[model samples]
Target: MFRIFVIAVLPLFFVFSSEIFTFLSGALCPSCNCESAKPLHRIPRPQLRPEFLALENGTDARLGCEDVGYKMHVFSREPLVVYFENFVSAREREHLLDISEKIYTPSTITHNGGQTSDRNTKVRDSEVALVPRTEGVRCIERRAREVQGWREEVWIERLRVQRYNPGGHYSHHFDWSSGRGGWGRVSSFMVWVHGEELEGGGTEFPRLELRGDKKKWCKFIECEDNLDGEDSKDKGVETAEDKKGAVFKVIPGNAVYWENFRSDGTGRGYNETWHAGLPVKKGVKVGLNIWSYGRID
Candidate 1:
C-alpha cells in the first residue's frame, strides 16, 4: 500500500510543486503587519461622505455634475511626486475663489517674535482662507482621498486656499512639522486657480529635478528653465533659485502631490520635498492646500 501511494503521489508532486510551494510559503510566512515588517507606502484614508456613496443612483446622484476626468503623471518616485491635470474643474475653481474671498484673513509671518503683514513678500506673503468643509470642499476631499487609494484610519486637515496678489509668494519651506503639530504631515496636495493673465507664482522644488518625460512634462512645468528654473521679475530681475530645482508653473485646475515623509517608515520629512511658492509677477493667483495626516504616534 505504501509503495502504491508513493507512486501515485510522485506524479502529483511534479505537476503541482510550484503552486504548492507558493501556497505553503504564503500560509506559513510571517504576517506583513508584524512589528518588524516594513511600513506601507500609502497613507491612511477616510471613508466617503453619504453623498458620494449614493453613486448607484447614477445621473441623479449629487456627484453626477461634479464628475472629473483628470489624469495623473509621475514626476518623481523616491519622494513620490506626481502632477495632476484637470484635477479641479472650472466651476469648482470659481466656487473656491468665491468662497475664499468671503472668509480670507491676511496671513501673517513671524519675524523676531513680532507679526508681519501678509504682504511681507519675504517668506509667505498671501492671504489665507481656512475654508470650512462645504459641499464643494467635501467633494474635493473625497476625490483627493480616492485618488490616493487610502481607506484606513482617516485624518484630513482643513483646506487652505492662499490668495496671492502681484507680489505675493511663499518662500522655501517643508510642509512636515516635527514638534507641536504632532505626527507631522503624511502628504500634501496643492492645486492652482489663477485669474486671467497670471504670471510667475509657480511652486519651486529646488532640490528636485526632472530628467525624463520631456514632452509630457512641458504641459505641467516650464521646460525652458533647464533642470532648475530661473523666473525673472517684471523688471527682469532674477528670482532666488539660480540652478538647483524645478518649477511647476501655475496651470489652472492642475495639482501637485507629494509624500512628506521619508519612505523608511520613520515618519521623518524628506529633504527633497522642500519647496517654495515663487512670487507672482503679474495677475492674481489662488492656490489650494490639502494636507493629509496619519494617526498620532
Candidate 2:
C-alpha cells in the first residue's frame, strides 16, 4: 500500500514540476503559450506601462514619469509628434511577420495581383495581431496624453497590419469612429517597417480653406503637387501650413505618430486631419497601425 501511494505521489510531483517549469520558462500556459501561439486576424494591442497605471492608481498623481506621459519631451494640444528612430527590432520584426502569416491568412480582400485593400473601416472585420512590444508605442501615447492634459487610462484598443502591394492604395478617410458607444480614441500612430521608393501613395489631409478660390491655397501649399502633380486637381486641394498634411513617408524602421484628439479634449475631430492613401505606383508598403484608446477602467 505504501509503495502504491508513493507511485501516485510521484506522478503528482512531476506534473507540478512541469507547471513550475513552464512558468519559469514562460512557455506553457493553460490559456496561452507565447512561444507557440500567436494573435490572429487582428492588430496588436498597445504596450502600456504597468508603472504608469500604478502611479495613477497610487497617490501623488503629480509625480510624473520622466518618459511616460508626454511624447518626445514636447507638450502640445494640437497633436504630439514623435520621430520613429526605430520601431521594431530585426528579430522581433521578423517574428511579427511570421506570426502575422499564421493569423493573417489573407483572404481575397487582403491579397491580390500586387494590391490589397480593406474597404470596410470597421475594426472587427480587419485582421490583427497581439504584438508583445511597446517601447515605440508607449513613447507616442504618453506624450499625446500629456499634451492633451486628460487623465484617462490609455490602452491599445486594437492594432491591424495592412499591406499594400504595388499599385495598392486606400482612398481618403478619417481614422476616428463615427460616434458609436466608443468615443475615447484620442489618437493614432503608423510606424513604417520597410522603406522604399514608391509613388502615388501619400497620406493626404484636407487643407484649411482659403479666403478666395481654394485652388489658390492649394497652389500655395503645393502638397498635392509634391506627390502627384498640378493635373491631379480633382482630388480636392486645401492649403496647409508648411505642408502639414497627414500624407507622409518615413525611412524603413521609422514611425509616423499622429494624435486624433486635440489638446482641449472636447472630443472634436480635426477637420484638417481628414486624410487618405493615394494609389501606390510601385513597390509594396508594409506598416503597423497603433491606435491608442482613452481611459478604460
Candidate 3:
C-alpha cells in the first residue's frame, strides 16, 4: 500500500514541478544578468508629475466626443458599405440647415458618356447647395475622414447638401470620375441631416446581395420581401421599383460610408458600387455628401 501511494504521488509532484518551471521561464526578465535573487526594497508610489497630470486631462478632453452616442454597422463587404447611427450632432445638423436655407440650386449629373454638358436632365430632380467649409463643417469632415480610415484631410472634397422633395431623386451613377486628374473618389459619406417625417428617399445599391437577418437591418436598410428578382441591366436609371438592391432608409443624423474602388490594387471603380437616391414619397429629405479622393488608406 505504501509503494502504491508513493507511485501515485510521485507523478503528481512531477506534473506540478513542470507547471512551475514553465511559469518561471516565462516570468524571468531576459535583460537581468544576475541569476541570484535581488533583495526586496520598498518601492515608493509614483507621484503625479505636472506633465503626467496634463496628459491625463488632455486625454479626457479628447475623449469627450466619444460620448455623442454613435454605432457602426457594416452592411456589405464588397464595395464596402457601412451604416452609421447618430453620425451628426443635433447642433451640427441645425447649423447646416440654417446656413443653406436659401442657397439651393438645381442639381446636375455628369453625362453617362463622361462628357461635360449644360442641359438639365430629368435623371436627378433634387436641389443641391454647396456648404461652405466653416469650422463646424470642417470638424464634420475630419470625423468623416477618420471613419474612412484616412489620415489626411486633403483628400476630402467640399461638402454638398442636397434637399429632396416628394418627387426628387438621383439615378444610379459612379462618384469616381475618369477625368485627367490623378485623383479619383475613393470613398463617399452621405449623412442625413433632416428627413424626420420623410418617406421613401433611400440610397439603393443595385448589385449587392443582402446577408444576415432582414428584420435587424430593416432598422437602417429598406429590405424587401422579394429581392430574388433580377435588377435592371441599364445601370438603375429606372424607378426604385424596377431596381432590386439594398436600399438604406433616410434616417436623421445617420450616414452611410462606402468604398468605391476595388481592393485588388487596380485603382478602378467597382461595378457594384453603382447606387441611386430613390425618390421621396412623402416629406422632404436633406442630406450631406462628403466625397474622399486620392489614396484610400
Instruction: Give candidate 3 misplaced runs (Cα > 4 Å).
Output: 1-67, 111-119, 152-154, 179-182, 224-244
Residues 1-297, candidate 2, lDDT per residue (tens digit)? 999999989978887986666565533332222342222222234445553221232333443324312123211224454434445455444544664555653322332311365535331222344443343333333443454455555655444555666655655556654322224455666655544785545545554232323343342223444336553435555434333444455345555556664443233445544555565577766666666565321
For 1-297, candidate 3 gives per-residue lDDT tens digits of 999999999988787986765456535631122233222222233333332111122233233343347799887887688889999989989989988889998887666433564435468888888877566776686677667665442356668899999888988877766422323566888899999878889998878777666568877776444334554434444433433578888889999898876544334466677789988899999999987655422
**C-alpha lDDT score of every prediction, in listed order:** 0.71, 0.46, 0.70
The candidate 1 region of ten consecutive residues with least summed lDDT is: 51-60
Candidate 3 residue 220 Cα shift, in angstroms, is 1.0
Better of 2 and 3 by TM-score: 3
Candidate 1, 1-297: lDDT as tens digits: 999999999999999997776566545642222233334334444343442121212322265347879988888987789899999999988888888888988877644212242345577788998876567877887788787775454456678899989899888987765412224466899898765688888898988867565655767776543323443444455333332467898988999999876645534466788898898899998999887765423
Best by lDDT: 1
Better of 1 and 3 by TM-score: 1
Model 2 misplaced stretches (Cα beyond 4 Å): 1-77, 105-151, 179-182, 208-246, 295-297
User: What TM-score does each of the candidates earn?
Assistant: 0.68, 0.49, 0.67
lDDT for model 1, please: 0.71
